[model samples]
Target: MKVVNKGLRAVAVLEACKGVVSLLVGFGLHVLAGHNMRQFAENIVSRLHLNPAGHLPSIFIHSASSLTDARMGLLAIGALVYSLIRLVEAYGLWNGLVWTEWFALLSGAIYLPFEIYEMIFHTSLLGVGAFLINIMIVGYMAHSLFSQETTDNQI
Candidate 1:
């Protein structure tokens, strides 16, 4: 039970961190929507000393350059929504709510396909690590849920 509590807290922290990052991204998109996105992206590339013609940098610049204010605003709203959901889930998990285990399991499982696709096609160390971490979290949640169910049934 102590180990289970620790695991739940750990996952809660992870979810909270993700929520904070999404919130920051939402704010950043909102701010950038009113500015010259092309110039902003170029500045980032220059500051990072990245070659503008490089694959990743070029894609970043092109994507930013093509975004309209409306689209950027829409993306900001989407990020905000995602952040809220994650934050709420984190709160519930931190409180050890049974429903949150189900929510976390479902939400984490949803990303498995995308993560697998990333590992197969993109094949980056970061992508692989993310996939592994997500799998572990989902596995833990599943175990927690089923173990509780078995215990209750036995009782």
Candidate 2:
């Protein structure tokens, strides 16, 4: 309710929404595992006008089609945990908590190395955008945290 920065508010809202979507996806994956994945993949490919033999498409189809109940369960549990963390961070940030800002910075920085590695090995526009956005978020939060400390010291 006291988010002073528009950018921070937007990030908080986005994170909350992302968490919700991730939760839904995890549940969907669990439910879909009981269905005929090959048929589902074929339907998706046809709907998207994708070639079945294309490397990325084929890999996706193969991976999805081969998912087991245990794997899907584990994935769902992980997604739920991730979603909860994101939601908590979003709530704290929205309330303008300084500790939440620090948490965001640390979390975002933790992903930088992995993102960089992904860019080096499997570069894509979406990946680049994700990396850049994360960097910006972390930089902005860091700047805000330090600037606030400096201002407080001066007072």
Candidate 3:
């Protein structure tokens, strides 16, 4: 790949690594929470099921629905999808792929504020690093893209 692309690739790899780590940790937590939630819901529903109070059926139905709905499962799946997409964009960034870079630029720019907010509200080492890294990469990529366009216009 070209030197520019090589630099992009480096950035992309870093982003991908970050995404993978976050997704795995999130997934683990989701699973643990899901397990506990299901158990609690089941226990409550079972007791309600045994009681036959007029409202018991409604309670059991609601509790059963809550258990089976598995919002945690949906959250885990969403996180997986987002993580994969981010990694793909990172690959594009690493190789200095124009379209990939643009995608990364727009997406990164959008997320930058959220990251900043997170850092300001809840400071942490990783959050600070992520905020700074995203700002730098997005700025660099935006410049590279615009400059290339300007150069091409003169040609």
Question: For model 1, what is the error of residue 57's alpha carbon versus the real structure, in angstroms, after optimal superposition?
Answer: 2.1
Model 1 lDDT, residue 28, Cα: 91
N/CA/C clash count, model 1: 0
Q: What TM-score fits each model?
A: 0.94, 0.88, 0.64
Which has the better lDDT: candidate 1, or candidate 3? Answer: 1
After the best TM-score superposition of candidate 2, give how far the Cα of residue 71 lies from its true spot, in angstroms.
0.9
Ranking by TM-score: 1, 2, 3
Candidate 2 overall lDDT versus native: 0.86
Q: Over the stretch 1-155, how does candidate 3's per-residue lDDT look in tens digits?
A: 33565667677887798779769965864765536554565566667565434476557556544653356667677778888887888777766668887887888899888998999899999999888888998898788888888988999
lDDT of each: 0.93, 0.86, 0.74
Runs of candidate 1 exceeding 4 Å displacement: 1-4
Clashing residue pairs, backbone N/CA/C < 3 A, model 1: none
RMSD of 2: 2.0
| Model 2 worst lDDT window (10 residues) | 1-10
Model 3: residue 105 alpha-carbon error in angstroms: 0.7
Q: Write the per-residue lDDT of candidate 1 for residues 1-155, one digit (tens) a residue.
A: 22348899899999999999999999999988889999999999999999999999999999989999999999999999999999999988998888888999999999999999989999999999999999999999999999989998999
Report the number of the highest-lDDT candidate: 1
